[model samples]
Target: MRNLLIFCYFLLFFIGLSCKETKKEDINITTDDIEVSDNLQAVTKKSKSILFFGDSLTAGLGLDIEDAFPAIIQRKIDSLGLSYQVINAGLSGETTAGGKNRIDWVLKQDVDIFVLELGANDGLRGVPLSETRNNLQAIIDFVRQKNPEVKIILTGMQIPPNLGVEYTTEFKKIFPELAAKNKLELIPFLLENVAGIPDLNQADGIHPTKEGHKILAKNTWEVLKDVI
Candidate 1:
């Protein structure tokens, strides 16, 4: 009887030791899995995001949310299986001054690229070219100050012929000047191919149609693909 009891005790000790070792191995595997998951999440978060700042032109004015230029660009990126998020900060009827006021809010996001598309409404409203320029320059300066590494893509706007040749010329110069000064990628005119096309524009003759939005997306992608 004494021998049997001793044998039982030894058996229990070995079994307990094996169980403890098994548990430790499981814990280590679980910890490794958690660490891998965390690292993958960090990589996903570091992917690029873009912010589109402009007026109705960028807002898709009369169009649906999915039809907006920002959304269009996002779709294009997704189709290519690229990781990107494009936030549209466009406000209808917003001028350069409005953009200046709201720029801080726009920069609050984790933005990798900023597509500055303001001053179009300023030109439309006949706002002074200097004020428009100052407002736009201030916005660029503020953004650069906050994030020097953030890429900027400046999109130009053209005034209607009714705005007159002299005013139009000065208004058009604002984008190039700012782009050159800041060393930004410039899209000479956002509506280059679609602006005058009757079928591409909405009845208002200001905003672009769905097809027009696609063209604008292509224009943005031309510059964006290289950077991101």
Candidate 2:
């Protein structure tokens, strides 16, 4: 009778041990699942942000936010599985001086890439080419000082033919000169494909239309892909 009681107790003990082992296995699986979830979330949160700091050209003046060049670039980044955010800091009628004035405010935001596309309005307003260059240089220096790692892509602009060849030539040189001096990337001209195309321009030839914005996005991406 004692032997029978001992056998029954051993059987119950073995069953209890098996149940505890199974529970431990379940807990380990749950822990692994939670860890994987946390890792995924962290990856999702570390996405990069690119800032498009320019005039109306970058702002999509007449177009919707989604149609802006910055937004289009964001879409490309997403399609390519590159984690990025494109912040539009464009202001219509903004000159190089205006850009310089507001650069500090723009820098307060988390900016990774700054697509500097000023000077067009300055050229249009007949601002001194030297003044334009000075303003742009200041803005570039400030940005570099604040975030050395932040990439800058300078976009060149040409003055209207009526602005006289001398003035236009001087205005044209500002971008290349600054780019070379700062060792920054240059887009050459933001309106390369769509500048003079009547169909690409809105009522005012100064600002680009929706179609023009599409081309601008392509121009930006060509240089941006390299940096990203």
Quote each prediction's TM-score: 0.79, 0.79
Residue pairs with colliding backbones in model 1 are none
Off by over 4 Å in 1: 1-46
User: Per-residue lDDT for 4-117 in model 1, tens only?
Assistant: 999999999999999999998777457888889966764685387788999998999899989988998877887887777777899999999999998888787557898999
lDDT of each: 0.88, 0.85
State candidate 2's TM-score: 0.79
Q: Per-residue CA lDDT of candidate 2, range 51-141, in tens?
A: 8888888888888988888888878887887777677888987888889989999889556888898988888888887898999999999
Q: Where in model 2 is the C-alpha error above 4 Å?
A: 1-46
